[model samples]
Target: MKTILLHVSLVLCAVSSLQSRTWTEAQTGRKLEADFVKVQGDAVVVRAANGSTMQLPLARLSEADQTFVKEQAETATKPATTAAKTEEKSSGKEDAKKALIGTWDGYMADSDGSRHGDIRLVITEEKITASNPRGGQEMGAGTYKISGKRIDATGTEGQFRGKKYEGIFDLDSKTLKWCSANDNPNSSRPTQMQTNPQAGQFLMVLEKK
Candidate 1:
């Protein structure tokens, strides 16, 4: 009986020692040896014996390492997360500015020496609408597709006209030139005249508004 009791105590001590030096994944409930874990600021940088490093949230660490890891995580995540957020914001701004969202003045001249006069284009998030100030008439709304520097607009041309025209508007120079190709179906001419088939192709020139 004495020998059996001693063996049981030895097993208990071994189990306790093992538990003290290990960590378990809170989400998946998987256990990992503690010696393989390293505490790097706000991030718990873990390096396995095999030499692979994985960074995790500091909160995921054990209580004993929490204090030190929390501080490190804060410092490390701040700059990294802030930089990631800044990059996302910059990407969004570029996307919004890629299209001609504001108002634009446009003119189209036909091959017959007749000009269609000046027109105002107002593009909103939902649709692209245009109007002719001379007649105070709405040109109806249509959908548009804008690429890096090219714009293809298609919309209603009012009661007497059809609603489809593909043109390229270059926003860099604030110049817009498009043609009414829907009216003349047989004409193979380019829809609008511009230096490039792209929009936003001109050099960026900005002044304080």
Candidate 2:
């Protein structure tokens, strides 16, 4: 959990770096060069070039800086609201339970982008039926839960039965990318869409069928 949090923090910092700019104090007109982190309550969090983070009250910033901070905050939140509404509408429900209920055809690829094997999946509200093909021999059965872009699944059949997996996924109307790591003994969930089979991470690119 801490790893995930740290990864997210790093990503946010990188984004802030790209948006680094000058901020002016309203009363003294003192200018500070910093990267905008986030707006907390009535204050804005910023990171200096020296890697120090500090919070300044919105009232202390110039009008233009305050406007910039509010705009940044709104821009950050709009996509989440839009995505939630889109998913709810597409699933024809208030949640994501049925959003992934369908047949998917894809191949598992190794770190070097070599296809290991072709696979098919039939997903329902809570269960996943995996196989080599649409009607070929069954590979495994599992139960999964989705929270935003993260998927938590546990195998319930075959050799992998009782094994837990954690992954991140990007799903749309046509394509889905599922990248995961086995969480049996010790493995961290993937933070990006890449695979390292030697490290127990895998990537699957699938298309709805």
Candidate 3:
């Protein structure tokens, strides 16, 4: 029993010794010692050595950190390298995810195109803060998650509290088009346009700043 207890203790120690590395964020040059959690559509989420969670954009990471991501991207390809199509697809997703970092600004509008609001949205590797003002009234500041073109958002405070929203990002044009959900059963969110609005929907068009 004594020998068995000693071996178990040794195993636990080895497991506990597995430590995460400290990573430097590129845009801010801030360092975070953490274990990588996963790569979401637009950011890398990590659990810090101190137990804090963070989300950072790839472009926001330091060059070394970006190199780390490139290495990871290469490493991720090893398993699927046997299939050409799968490799291309994985590479595409990785590229698209990286391009999503930056600040985007534009305007929001109601479905009828008559009423509009100013919009400013900033995206880092891990968090998105979006603000849309209606006639100088701040409706909310939202935090969002992106996967492919799909976006899911939650209002952190204000009247937007307890509300959820959905939207899309057009990666190529650096445009983000998203909206709050319509309350009525038959209605859908508005489509993004440069000039006019669609019916019964609210739309926003923000270009990267």
Candidate 4:
């Protein structure tokens, strides 16, 4: 009876030690709040609310976050990769294809937190339209496509003057990001533009109406 009691106590102690170790590792390994900023080739850029940016391996993130990072990274790394592949197999132009066919509202901001704007995207089967409903400015006409849950759009009518604009819309969530050409004849010249030339990339968070 004494031997059995001693063995049972030993087992309970071992189990408690294992559980404590597991709980400690989990607490340390857990990500508090992460924002997927960008992808540079094989690395993923994530920004935490603490204002620290980290470029980590794509495999380190959770499954859902990994998928989001992969899609964003692929889109950033290979411009027109999807369009080229799809265009070769399909007879129709990819621009005429509409993947962002819905209403979206979001907040727009540059790399710097100074300048901000509100955006609305109205997409149809044939066209994708966006507007700054708050500023009373029209973003103009565009074409869009969805690749791996991300929406890629190229504006034909020019959003800032005559500058051509392209955007990657995350459909799984409400993130709208776009970059406009710097030296397009249709786009406003750098000297006349309000935002910095280097800050042409617009990142916005969309709210559903």
Selected candidate, larger lDDT, 3 vs 4: 3
Best by TM-score: 2
Q: What is the C-alpha RMSD of each candidate to the true structure, in Å?
A: 15.5, 15.4, 20.4, 22.1
Quote the positional error of residue 201 for candidate 3 in Å.
Answer: 2.9
Runs of candidate 3 with Cα error greater than 4 angstroms are: 1-91, 112-115, 132-139, 179-200
Which candidate order results from sorting by lDDT in descending order? Answer: 2, 3, 4, 1
Residue pairs of candidate 3 with colliding backbone atoms:
26-60, 26-61, 26-62, 27-60, 55-126, 56-125, 57-125
List the candidate 2 regions with Cα displacement exceeding 4 Å.
Answer: 1-95
Model 4 TM-score is: 0.37
Reference-based lDDT, each prediction = 0.47, 0.77, 0.59, 0.48
Cα distance off (Å), candidate 1, residue 118: 2.8
- What's the residue-level lDDT of 204 in candidate 4? 56
lDDT of 4 by residue, 1-209 (tens): 32332232332211111100011112236654555555444444556667686665544445555455434434443545777777775543343233344677865555564447677867687666778877767768766555433344556775533334433444334343433334344443222213344544445566545
Off by more than 4 A, model 1 = 1-99, 111-115, 156-164, 179-209
lDDT of 2 by residue, 62-162 (tens): 87886676556556656768998887766644255566789999999878777778999889987888888846989888999787788888999975589
Model 1 residue 118 lDDT score:
59
TM-score of 2: 0.53
Clashing residue pairs in candidate 2 (N, C-alpha, C atoms within 3 angstroms):
none
